[model samples]
Target: MEHAPMSDWTTLPRAFYQRHPTVVAPELLNKLLVRDDGRAGRIVEVEAYAGSEDPAAHSYRGMTARTATMFGEAGHLYVYFSYGMHWGSNAVCGEVGQGWGVLLRALAPVHGLALIRAARPAIRRDTDLASGPGRLSQAMGITKALDGADLVRNDRGVRIACDGTAPPPEPVVGPRIGISKAVEFAWRWHVPGHAHVSGRGSRSR
Candidate 1:
C-alpha cells in the first residue's frame, strides 16, 4: 500500500488518544510516526499498558519521577530508559493521571531509509532497523530528551501522523512480551504476517 505523501499527512488529533490504551493500540496500526528530519515509519506492532489495574505497567504503584510522563496528558511521548542499556517510547493515552500507554513495538520503514540505515549500522537487514522497542527508539533518534514531548503538536518536531493508510482489519492479538508480570493479558496487537513485528507470541482471541 502506498503511503500518503508527506504533504498530505495529518497529525493525529488529541481526541484520537483520549481513550484507553487497548482501544488505541490496535487502531494505531499502519499510522505513521514522523520526525521533522524526514524519518517516518508505519506502525505495525504495539502493546497496551493499563495503569493501576495492570501489574506490568510502570505506573501501577503510583506516580514517581520516572513515571511522571506516563501520567501526563494524552498524546504525549513517554520515553523510558530500559535495563540501563536502551530506551523505549510509548504514546501516552487516557486522561491525565490515568497512566495508560501503548508501546510501539515495531515499525515498517516508510521514509528516510538512508537515515534509518545510517542510524542502525549494526542492523544488516532493513526489516530489523526498528523491529523492537529499544531498536525503534535508536532508529528514530528518540531518547530521554524526548520523554514527555508532545506528539499531538508538531512543535516537538515529532508526531504521529495518518497518511490515509487504514489499520489492519484483523490484527494478530497476543500477550505483551518481555514482561514478567501479567503474562496472561492479551494486550499485544500486530499486523498479521508483518516481518517487522518484534517477537513471536501465541496469538489469542
Candidate 2:
C-alpha cells in the first residue's frame, strides 16, 4: 500500500462531519476513498443512518461493542459484517458519541481497476465492481480491521480525500435499502442515473 501524493487532494476534516447524517451523506459525493495500496474509488452513492432517532441506525437500540464505532468520533470508518458473509462500511458523521454515519453505498472505480477486479472476481464490468455497500467494501479491501480508522489522515490504511471533482448531477433520494427495518425512511442518496448505484434503491431513486 503506497501513499498517494496530496497534490490536489485534501483530507476532509472532522468538522465536515459534525452536521446531521442527511447533510453529510450527499456531501460525500465525488470524494476519493483511497486505500493504502493506492486503490481509489470516487464516492457516488451513500445512505445516511441518523442516530437513535432513526430506527434503521445501528445506534437506534443503543450502543454495543458491534455498534461502538458508530458512536465514536466523526471522520472515522465504521466497517461492519453484514448478511453473515459480506462486509459493509460507513463514514462516521455527527459529533463524538452521536452514532450517526453515512453508509458508503457505491463508488465509481477510479485508482485501481485491476486490483479491485482481483478482489472481486465475479465482476465482469467495471460498473458492477462497487455497486453496493458490501461489494464496495470488498472491492476496496476494507474489512473489520479498519472499523474505526481515521479517514481524515493521509497515512491511514484508507483515507477520503478531496479531488476537486465537479459534483455529479444532483443527488436523488430514496428509501433505505436491504434492511427491513425502517424501510420507508428516505435516507438513501445517490447520483441520478449513475450506473454505480446499488440495485436495492434504484427503482425508487
Candidate 3:
C-alpha cells in the first residue's frame, strides 16, 4: 500500500491512551508514529504489558528510576534499554500510577525512507527496517532520552498520529516474544499477513 500524506494525519488524543494496555494494543494497528524530523511508520505489531499481575512487565514489582516513565500519565513514550544492547519503545497507557503500556513491536515504514535506511544500514529489505522492537527504536531514533516524552502534547515533535486507517477488525494474537513469565497471556497483536511483521506461526492465531 502506498503511504499517506503527512498532512492528513492527526495526533491521537490523550484519552485514546487512557485505557488498559490490552484495549489499546490492537487498536494501535495502522496508526502512524511520527517523529519531528519527518520519519514515520505505521504501527503493525504490539504487545500489552500490565502492572502487578503481569510478571514480565518492568513495573510489575513497582516503579524504579528505570520504570518511572511507565507509571506516568498516558500518552507518553516509555523507552528502555534491553539486554545492554538495544533500546525498546512503548506507549504509556492507562491512568497515572497504573503502570501499563503497549510495546511497539514492528512498523511499516511510511515516510523518511532514507533516514530509516541510514539508521539500519545493515538491513537489506525495507520491510526489515522496523520489524522488531529494537529495530523499531533504532530506526525511529528512540532512546532513554525520550523515555518521558509526551505524545499527547507533541513534546520534542514526536507523537502517535492517526491517518484515517482503522485498526484490523481481527488482529493476530499470540504470546509475547522473549519473555519467561506470563508466557501464556497471549498479549501480542499484529496486522495479519503484513510483510513487516517480525515473527510468525503460532503468533497468528
Tens-digit lDDT track of model 3 for 38-86:
8999999999999987999999999999999999999999999999999
RMSD, model 2, all Cα superposed?
3.3
Candidate 3 accuracy as TM-score: 0.97
A best-first ranking of the candidates according to their TM-score comes to 1, 3, 2
Off by over 4 Å in 1: none
Could you give candidate 1's per-residue lDDT for residues 61-111 as a string of tens digits?
989999999999999999999999999999999999998999999998999
C-alpha lDDT of candidate 1 relative to the true structure:
0.93
For 26-118, candidate 2 gives per-residue lDDT tens digits of 889877888878688889888899878898788898889999999998989998899899898999998888899999989988777889999
Query: Model 2 segments beyond 4 Å from truth?
Result: 1-6, 200-205
Q: Which ten residues in a row have the lowest lDDT in candidate 2?
A: 1-10
**Clashes within 3 Å, all models in order:** 0, 1, 0
